[model samples]
Target: MKLINWWPPMLGTGISLKKVSKDMTTFEVIMKLRWYNRNLVGIHYGGSLYSMCDPWYMFILMANLGKGYVVMDKAAAIRYKKPGRGTLKCVFHISKSEIKEIRSEIDMIGKKDYTFTCEVMDEEGEVVTEVDKVVYVRKKDFDFEALEKEKEAGNTKIPG
Candidate 1:
């Protein structure tokens, strides 16, 4: 939370993660409609709304799936349902059972693309944006121990 609060893109756009569950399966991000983050028409910028929804599912998957799997966002789509105003929030959550299902599917198929949908809402709880993210997960064939050693040696970076 401390490190991510300083993330440049989020900080620049006024988007901030408000809270995260202890297990990292649930979190909330919020953005207040400010001069810098508004669209020309005086609503939340599409990019900011989308940004609040991005990367979260992948982050959750990576946390739950361990080091033996690859998790990345494969694609995404966003729709502006209504003009957002004031403080807008997006709540991200995926159940443990759902994660287990995804793992089971990946174990059987070797890889899978899982799509999850979430909404960005206004203070009144009316949806302002709808986003569907496709996350890709696959088993890794490489040695996790070797990767860890390389990471400790400061010589390798893993891609999400």
Candidate 2:
């Protein structure tokens, strides 16, 4: 979590990864309004608001989905409900049962789009921005353990 807080994009935009739950199911991020990140009107910039939400849903899914599945961000839409001036924060969480539900769906259909909504709120606890994110999840077609075993035994071939 500390390393992620220092990530270049987050640092550049004054975003911070504030916390991660012990179960890896929940994450908190904050963007404090600053001179460098504000728009001409002196409120939070749309890009900054979008940036705060850009990558968290994918991460939440990845942490819960495990190694046998592939997860990628598909699409996003942000609706700004009101002007934001103070610190803005968002919480990203996916229940373990929800993860299992996603896995079942992928297993049954091979691949599918899953959508989650994240809301950015201000100090007064009113929503300032709403972000809808779509994630693409698919189960790996081959056994990863078997492929690893083949590579360890020097029997796997690679195309040059």
Candidate 3:
């Protein structure tokens, strides 16, 4: 995907894509918690805070894993450490070599799942949120004939 299209979502929300690596393993995005992103208590809006991290890791996964594999968010968890003031930054990093390894495994075993974790840090480098993402990946083409056989035996339910 082009960086131009990637900028709007972030800029629209007052966030910025500060950096993205050539290997697609690491990215840095920044956000300024303005009035629109403030809660009743004047703290940063939770949704906006969460938005700072959206799609970055998944994008990285998609870019590195190549085609014929499915990469999804799967799940996420965030820890609000200290309240954000001024601006906040989320630095996302993945291991390109590790992704290569995962791809190798998927090619070898046909199907495999992997998890990658990244941290969002404030300017002081204090982690504001720690996110763990699980992604399921497998070869796109599988034994459809086996599935058909199972269906013929009434052991499977085919979706209409």
Candidate 4:
């Protein structure tokens, strides 16, 4: 499914895409804390905090890169800076130059992997969570026929 469709699930969990630019390279998504989203201490649940961070950067990259390339959130490491009490917002931004630089690096290295960083900030504009995300990108020349066959045979699960 398209990435935009994910908005529903995010919203269902109190996350809202407040603003998405026309280019869709930068976006502001907010997650409000409801009673259900609170932990025993009545702060934002850690799992929900992590969940709110789940998709912004990857979506930004995909929308910026168009279609020839594929981007995935291969791995993520989040460092929570402080307790979240009120509403939370994560602003994700990817520029053309950044995307171009990534492409150039991949072209020079052939099929390989790369990583980028994104941050989720609180109302104070302080980073509440810092995320290090790794993305595995491969070129069309890379041998994938066998892998595709395996996927067709239900032996592999490729990231969408």
Candidate 5:
């Protein structure tokens, strides 16, 4: 997690991972308005705002769904409500019931798209941007028994 928080892309954009729940159901990200990330008018850059929201939903869903499933970011949209002048933050959360619903949907349809929304808020708690993300999820095409055996044998790498 520390490694990811310091990943070059994130670091370059002045984004930091503040917290991640033990169950991976919740995540918080902070974006400091630094000179490097500021736009021509000295406010937060649009690209930085989008980058701040890029990975959280996919990451949370993947962790909650386990290695048996495949999760990918399918689409995204960001609506800039106002310019962010100072530090801004966003939180992403997936309830247990929602996780269960996603699983059930995938089970029924073999694949499903889940949409999640989050808001980037300024220091005053006013929304500066609204982001909508869609993720594609489905069970992997592989032998579950074989995958379990490999996992037990410590021969496979399960991504979080």
Candidate 6:
């Protein structure tokens, strides 16, 4: 988590992780409009807004679903609604029931793709950007438990 906190792109864009729930179901991120991150007109950069939102969904799903699943960020799109002049915050949340639903869908289809929407808001709570993220999830074919046991025993090589 500390590694993520100091991640170069996030740091460069002035995006900070405020909180992450113990279960990884919720994450809060804030981006301050600093001199370095501001565009020529002194507003937040569009790329910065998108970077602020890039990773949370996949991170949350991976943590919640554990090693038995493969989770990836399949696609994303961001729409700039207004110029962000100050601090902007975005919260990402995925409920246990949602996780259950995803699992059910994956079990039924062998894979599932889900779209999540998030709104980035300014300090005054006006929407600054809208982001849509599509994540892909599927159960892994290998035995995760055995892999964990092997790693714990200091056997790094995978059996062919």
The digit string of per-residue lDDT tens for model 1 on 6-80 reads 898889889888898888899889999999999999988889888888988998999989998999999999998
- Which of the predicted structures, 3 or 5, would earn the higher lDDT when compared with the native? 5
| TM-score preference between candidates 4 and 6, better one | 6
What stretches of model 4 exceed 4 Å from their correct place?
1-8, 142-160
The candidate that wins on lDDT is 5
Clashing pairs in 2: none
RMSD of each: 8.9, 8.5, 5.8, 7.9, 8.6, 9.2
Ranking according to lDDT, highest score first = 5, 6, 2, 1, 3, 4
Clashing pairs in 3: none
Range of the 10 consecutive residues with the lowest summed lDDT in candidate 4: 105-114
Q: What tens-digit string does per-residue lDDT give for candidate 4 at 36-60?
A: 7889988878777777767777777
**Per-residue alpha-carbon lDDT of candidate 3 for residues 1-160, written as tens digits (9 for 90 to 100):** 4464356666566777878888888888887777777789876777677778778877887888778877777666676777776678877777867778777776555565566666666778887766666667776775657766777898864432
Model 5, span 48-116: residue lDDT tens: 999999988999888888888899999999999999989999999999899988887665445777889
Looking at candidate 5, the ten consecutive residues that score lowest on lDDT are: 104-113
lDDT for model 2 comes to 0.87
Clashes of each: 0, 0, 0, 0, 0, 0
Query: What lDDT does model 6 reach?
Result: 0.88
Supply candidate 2's per-residue lDDT for 143: 53
Between the candidate structures 1 and 4, which one is better when assessed by lDDT? Answer: 1
Which digits, one per residue and each the tens of the lDDT, describe model 2 over residues 25-118?
8989999999989999999999999999988878878888788888899999999999988999999999989888887766655577888999
Between candidates 2 and 5, the lDDT winner = 5
- For all candidates in order, the CA lDDT equals 0.87, 0.87, 0.72, 0.71, 0.89, 0.88
